[model samples]
Target: MKALRVLLLLSLVAGSGAAAEPAADTGREPFVFQSDRIDFDRERNLVAATGDVELAREGRILRADRIVLDRNTGIARADGNVTLIEPDGEVLFADSVELTDDLRDGFVEQFKARLGTGSRLAASSGQLQGGTRAELNQAVYSACEPCADDPSKAPVWQVKARRVTHDRVEQQVTYRDAVLEMWGVPVLYSPYLSHPDPDVTRKSGFLTPTVGHRSDLGVRIETPWFWNIGPDQDATFIPIVASQRGFIGAGEYRQLFDRGRLELSGSLATLDKKPKERARSGPRGHLRLKGESHAGDDWRLRGEFYRASDDGYLDLVGLDSSETLPSFAEAEGFFDRAYARVGVFDVQELRSGVSGDTSPLAGPELLYEWQDAPSPDGAGRRPAAGAALHRRREDENQRVTLEGGWRLERFTDGGHRLEVGAGLRGDFAHGDGAADDNNTRLLPQASAGWSYLLAGGMEDLQMTIEPRAQVVLGRNSADADEFPMEDNRAVEFEFDNLFALNRFPGLDGAETGQRIDYGVQTSLHGAGDWHVDAGIGQSQRRKANRDAPEDSGLDTAVSDIVGRVGLTAGEMTALGYRFRLDKDDLTARQTALDLSVNLDPLYFDARYARAVGVPDPQKPPGPAQDKEEREQVDVGLGSKLDANWSVLSRYRRDLDTGRSLLGGLGLKYEDECLLFEAAFEREYKVAGGDPDNRVSVRLVFRDLGSLPGTQGVLPGGRR
Candidate 1:
């Protein structure tokens, strides 16, 4: 019956506030001196009540066998199984308790308090001064609000501190003789510990370490120190140390500005590589710098820097060969509006140790535009529209270009279309040697063109025809003087849509030339998502001086035709073919063929090309006007696959050398926290360049902290 009564009494006082009122002295009955079952007395003006006494005021509740309230002073004391409850559902129990208003300052010989947020705090005996401070000795805190008697079974761990003082303003807790325990077992102890509060707004701390292995570098490790400086800025210092090719040291710095942010990284290694002669390479280093900024009115600046020792350093160290390093400086600036842009570009090479310095690539270009339409959203419909003036120089001679042109591109719901305007551009140059500025005749140049598109036979099947014409009025055109004139002819045909209908990589200039080009194209679909597209075109030109290569049947001809057909099967299958003809001789001048296949877990791409020069052409016996020639071919294949892991490979063939030009392969594997990759490739050339191989690895971790009770290493206590 006593236990039941005790349990009932606790239920009534749980989560209740402490209540104790002072007695009045204005002829009052000492608040209370006697009751039917209790007695009260005033000794030395100290109001004392005894026997099943219970006091309740405001929302606070106080219960005990005896209570003392000193009316003359501002203090209250409760003895024998005393319990004090606050309005916020925090209950405090102790053998004896004393408190002032606001609970700002309190004392309990033995105390335990349970807060509402699944947390509990306790100490043998202590004092709390409002939210700003708390001085505790031998305290234990935990996220778990354990059941009354099974604290060991709580789901969370607790941090124990011998002496701790917390500062609410700074949201930090400093402690001595601290121990972090889980299920009653102390996993860690600290003579002194300081950590961000549970509600700390600014988290500052140390970071975790990174480790990895590379066949070339052996082992690498790094630990970074992070500083939370303040709200607007922060920084970290990371020291990277690695073994394999001697000791390598590295560091990185980053900063954020009001208008932009910048990041810079650099590394150095002594005796880093195996040398061909008596000693290994001296000290080597790599640096990368980047930044981006924006101003008002569409004005922006951005750039990056990448440099290193001879390219071989990357290959030997298993780094990316594709990482092109420019020991030179290349800078560009842009100022623009929606319809116009002005820009300047400069390149200065720093490789020479000569007595003088010069910039080889320096130029300023200006272009203006007037438009009355919104820009197209697709790349195929993004046509150029402007007139540009540029100056060029080679060795000592210089020339200028004055060209004006217009192009219109639009994509309707059903198809795409383009209309291009031609321009008359004249190049005037002078040099010590007439051999430098090819054209001496000051040619009269003019050009114009139009193209159309029409769809038919289902949405997937479309046909397009682009017809173009250009007329030039003059040319000395002498084979002995290959120059004294520019040779702008046809282009080497490739998959690039840039000037697609115009074949031959522009080898000879078209002057005093009249040519009509006809292009007919079509696309079809079916089979493993197969896609087919084909096109054929023809052109013709005339020269003022017949001494031109046309006499060799390789220059100006009555007609030349080119055609290509290609098909794509699903994500991995492809096949293509190309052919060119010399109309005057009715013969073949070029031919090409290719095939490829790709699948998710697998991939492949291949290509082949050939150019046939006119060694001899018998203009079709009588008047038929058609010729035939030999072919020079170039071919390559690249592929990737996945089984136990992923792999990549590439192969190339150069018929001109009757040898393979290049080939390569690579493999990789990765998971949530760790990643690794390695590759070996070779690019063969009759002269210059070799196979470049590379390897790389990376790892990520979480909840990394200085100690169990400290702030996490990450920007946040995420893990």
Candidate 2:
């Protein structure tokens, strides 16, 4: 009943801008009076201006055909062509107006107002509760046309309301039955709405929701609610609605301290319940921590932690789209040219994993890194102090790493350059246990480099070629036996990024022992925006101590060959190839070739790989294992021909078995108002000729004038 009464009163007030007011004081003589006459009424203690009359008090001016002032009420009533001018450069006109001496707050009928700043407003009935605001019966707000000398006639966008209550203290207006209008044409309407007048502090309201679908998760719906919690913190709750059945929710919390900021998010419920039954679910969560702060003039502190509840949990629920999440913490800063850091890492428990299984491992890793930037002087550069400490539960032995490196670079005239570098390293690790334990030692370290470059060409032709060489001398005590190994994850965050012409994620692992790597690389660019480059190298490892010990698995060798080549035409076509050759057998141990092309809106990529004597990853491992030579070929096709549609397709085949291993497709639709997408993929097997995994995806979004269910969506139109 109260709400209804409020609504009823608002409706009346919106449509009616007229209100009665008492007459003003008549003791002071009016500065100006016009028309037929000025009448003084002693009995009523009122002064009246009749005919085409005008009255002035201080800087306020009033124009009306007739005016009456009451000494007791200090109110002024004007009829016919009533206008009020306040001290603050505001001119107000109305058919009938009742005002106080100050005119800061009052009532008016058929009100039309133009303020000091040229912003205009109008209402049929209203009450000016304060100097800069009013409770209007109906009002319009806009600044499309400047209210110049004649501000009343300016063009404007309006907000029509049945009733509007404007609060100067909060600088906002609340309304019922509001419609958005432009040039007097209604475009949108809403039952209730609120907006800040111009500038204000924190305000709470609804936010837009996102819609999408995943093959495994089915249809997806997420609506987020925002909370403006105090001044230093805020939060948002996003609820996910699944078509299949179940609610998965997520939220983010943020807070700021004097030294740092913190943010975290985790899912509370999920739709999939395969590996973990719903009974045991929702207890799992993830954590992340990162911060940076100044400690001294030249030293700083930084750290990052990323980890998930379980390894497969994120993959199953799609919480981790990147497939791999590492939980690690490190703190390191620099002083002058040198730097160092130490990090501790732990693995995220994998779902459906056996209690104690090894293999399929990267081993264990602990890293201590150091680096130094070069100075402008011609003095020799400094070397880095680095180390790695690692051990695996699967293998008996732990590992230790110590290394240092230095390099020099100089640019020559005519776009030429040169560089030289060297390094030393040592590694100690054991495998197996006690008597059966195998100890592997490497007193191996050496490096050298002499490289050159040239870049000068015709208007359309440019080229460069460089040759490099390095030497390493080291010894190895290799009685390391391979035990069932499990934990091995090496994580890196560095400024000295490695640049190579191969797709191998860990190419640096093979960079040890005594060896001299020599290679010449050449690059050419001519007409048609085409480019080509290739590199060939051979490594000569140290074996000077061969006569001192019996034969072990570790054999110091001579030159082993490695090379890579690549080419790209116009901006549309590309090709790449790389190979590793064993010096003892003169056979290529591993080879890969890839090709890609873009036909305007269409693009495609094909790749082939062969490991001459290796077994397939899907096959069993044991003595006398049936090792099907590892060979594979894959292709991907994607295109966006028109503005509204796009598609992507991928396929992979095992050449040796003549089998299709994988295939997938993705499609999308986009336009001015709506967006839609769909995707499907399958993981196939050879003998069964059936896919082991299948996936599908979809998403859609619409633009509404304002966020849904928000008070800002006046006129109820899409924003």
lDDT of each: 0.48, 0.55
Q: lDDT, candidate 1, residue 518?
A: 46
> Whole-model lDDT for model 2 versus the true structure?
0.55
CA shift of 316, model 2, Å: 3.0
lDDT tens per residue, model 1, 226-321: 666766555555565557666555555567777767777666667455344232467766677867666544555555676665444543443333
User: Residue 178 of model 2: what lDDT?
Assistant: 89
- How much does each candidate deviate from the true structure in C-alpha RMSD? 13.6, 12.0
- Candidate 1 residue 470 Cα shift, in angstroms, is 7.1
Give the winner by TM-score.
2
- Candidate 1 at 94: error in angstroms? 28
